[model samples]
Target: MHVNARFWDRLAPRYARMQVRDPDAYERKLAMTRAFLGPEAQVFEFGCGTGTTALKHAPHAGHVTAIDCAPAMIGIARQKAAEAGIGNVEFRVGDLADMPDSPGAYDMVMAHNVLHLLPDRSGALARVRRMLKPGGVFVSSTACAAGAPRLFRWVAKAGHALGLLPLFNLLTADGLRAEIAAAGFEIVEDWRPEGGRAPVLFLIARKPA
Candidate 1:
């Protein structure tokens, strides 16, 4: 389910504000990401909207390649990186489904709030896995189907009924785990933050060493 750029470009302001509103969640994911990455790790961050998480962790990784589909968000992300004087990061405008031809090129790949949005998640995970170096890690977070907000789910259902949002299966953690395993990734660590109206689950999986 590739979302149109308008959906994101229109929400860029609110999207950017998420960094401030949910600093703890972002920081937790960032800390987990750092723990998984080696000093010389080459990282690729998919859907790095406005560079919120990218800018936060780019300095810690050896090199950061961040990609996004929305041009407005990309512009913001590039500017954010520049203002931070970060020199080791590259930004691109593209979808995760059409990733570049660079197999086993990265030591880590990140996809915060990106997985469930894909209709072909298994295929995409396979691609991401291929992009990893031996023992490389894929650090990510998603709204676990079980943990998704009831109100939001009802809203989504209504939207789907009203032709607003597309309808797809609500994915649970088990579903995600199976997908990752099918993509040949092994789960290394997982977390579901406890203090939230709705919990956001994060996972760190690694390509076999």
Candidate 2:
């Protein structure tokens, strides 16, 4: 995770400037996520790049704690929050592993466009499960690239080897769902947006009450 921090730190500025690739899809995700939020909801978001989603959800949730390993990203996120006058979201520079355990601390936990980057997906899922209250929701949208063409996978691997990309787990959509279930989550919503170049799975799972 430390090694990946440097990669994200360097990319933070450019990443913040780049527009969302698919605005409609992004909006749909926000809408889906908002449906689970209430005025009293306490939320935790991991890999919260630039805190855009956190800020958006802050008004709907009572509070949001969002974290990323990259200091630069968190710095930008804090700046955005300040600019937006959004006080409910707390942006921090640390991954889940660095955070102190607070069992059942959050009503909802989100990991958007991030799960596939982790070296230990299952381990991270376990931690998320432990952090959420019973009946809490776990939301994630992950790119499942194992179905990509062999040549594309080879190029991606080569890019990572050359330090052009962060560590990416070649996960399949079904495989991700299975892992979530194995971690004691009962999936309630599973949807894929239409007409995407790559397969991205958007899921909402609940920790059994």
Candidate 3:
């Protein structure tokens, strides 16, 4: 996680400048997530990169605690939030696992493009489940590299070996869904957007009520 944090810190500026590869798909994700949010919803978002999604959701949610492991990312997020005049979000730099336990504290928890980078995906999901209230939704978008093209997978592996990329777990869509279920979530929506080299799985799962 430390290495990944440093990598993200270095990439933060460039990453913020890069546009979403699929704007339509990204918009769809935001809309779908917003549908589950009410005016009074309290949200927690982990690995909240530059906090674009958090800022977008802040209008609908009552409060959003956006956390990232990289200090640079959180700094950029704070700047963006301020520029957007979004006061509902509080951006912090820390690992999700280190967050003080407050059982059933949030109405919704989101992790976008983050799960595959973790060493303990199952344990992370379990912690997320514990943070949510009963019936609370967990929204996530994960890149299932195991389903990606062979060449791309090979390149990714080479990059990791060369220290150009962080550790990534090769996960399949079905495998991720099973893990979510095993973590005590009832699957609500599972979607794989069309036309990406790698499969990006977007899911909305609810804690059993």
RMSD in order of candidates: 2.3, 1.3, 1.3
Give each model a TM-score: 0.89, 0.96, 0.96
- Which is superior by TM-score, 1 or 3? 3
Ranking by lDDT: 3, 2, 1
Clashing pairs in 1: 1-119
lDDT of 1 by residue, 1-209 (tens): 23447667778777876645477866777787888766577999887889877777876878888998788889889888888899888999988877768998999999987786666887888889989998998988887765476887788667767756644447798888888888898999888888766556689999998
Give one digit per residue, the lDDT tens place, for model 2 in 1-209.
56689889999999999988788988998998999899999999999999998998999999999999999999999999999999999999988987999899999999999999988888899999999999999999999999899988998788788887788889998999999999999999999988988899999999998
Query: What ranges in model 2 sit over 4 Å off?
Result: 162-164
Tell me the whole-model lDDT of each prediction, alpha carbons only: 0.80, 0.93, 0.93
lDDT of 3 at 191: 91
CA error at residue 76 for candidate 2, angstroms: 0.6
